[model samples]
Target: MFLPIGQVKKTGLSCHLKWFEQHEILPLYKAGQFPNALCARFIPERPDVLAVAAYDGSKIIGMAGASADTPIMWQIGIDVEKNYRGRGVGTYLVTLLKNEIINRGKLPFYGTSLSNLHSWNIAINSGFIPAWLEVETVEQENYYPCN
Candidate 1:
């Protein structure tokens, strides 16, 4: 999905996910908590930028991340612990991240596997319309399920 640069709303919803800069979130992704699909290297040139994490005290239960696919376009992905699945954590964090991206003057979009209906729903709940399909080649190490 993609959003035209001019359509990013000036104001949007807020939430309690902990925000982190690209540098801060890289280590977490590398720590083996997130799977290969969510690894920062999945799309090397995309440049992971911001991440929002939801926690139960100090334990991270859910996370959503954004990467700059271009100067004005950013893409997002999410990961929620199995125990936390079906809850609203993913949607809230994604929505918060989307709003933050828009507030920062960039367009936010989400692309997910066709079989992953839950993820697609989260994107819709986060206000991302199904603009188009996005396909990209990935290294073997970046396409496996690593968890």
Candidate 2:
């Protein structure tokens, strides 16, 4: 289940938000500056993957992207450059990306580790609420029931 969150607000940062294009944004991915998740998913092969990047001048400062996990649901991910972090870049990117996804008739969702307060804060600030938790057993054969 997914919980509805509030709308996204404008961020007063002086940066440009642009849709991700393979020829343009692929260099950033190849530069190895982005987080692993961003690098892994920001590919041209998957048309369902979409991204919005925040640029400071000609440099990319942050990115928020989504991958369609299902026909109706998309999973969101984000990364901000170390030097540009904590300045609302993540929140701005996420807000823009989330709104774009919604405008395209899809649901956007986010997930992060419990210990990552920074990510959690970004999610909330960008209009997401705690809705569900995911758990899995990697080694099902080795698991035993305890009574």
Q: lDDT per residue, candidate 1, 1-147, as tens digits?
A: 644233323224333458888777667766666551255464568878888888887888888888888989888878888898787877777777788888898888888877778887877777777788767785775565765
Which regions of candidate 1 are displaced past 4 Å? 2-16, 36-44, 135-147
lDDT against the true structure, each candidate: 0.73, 0.74
Q: Report the lDDT of model 2 for residue 14.
A: 70
lDDT of 1 at 69: 84
Per-residue lDDT tens digits of candidate 2, residues 1-147? 233384677688778868874455555566665562265535444433677888888888888867667768877888898999899998888888788778878888887877789988888888889998866557677566894
User: Residue 53 error for model 1, in Å?
Assistant: 0.3
| Highest TM-score model number | 2
TM-score for every candidate vs. truth?
0.76, 0.77
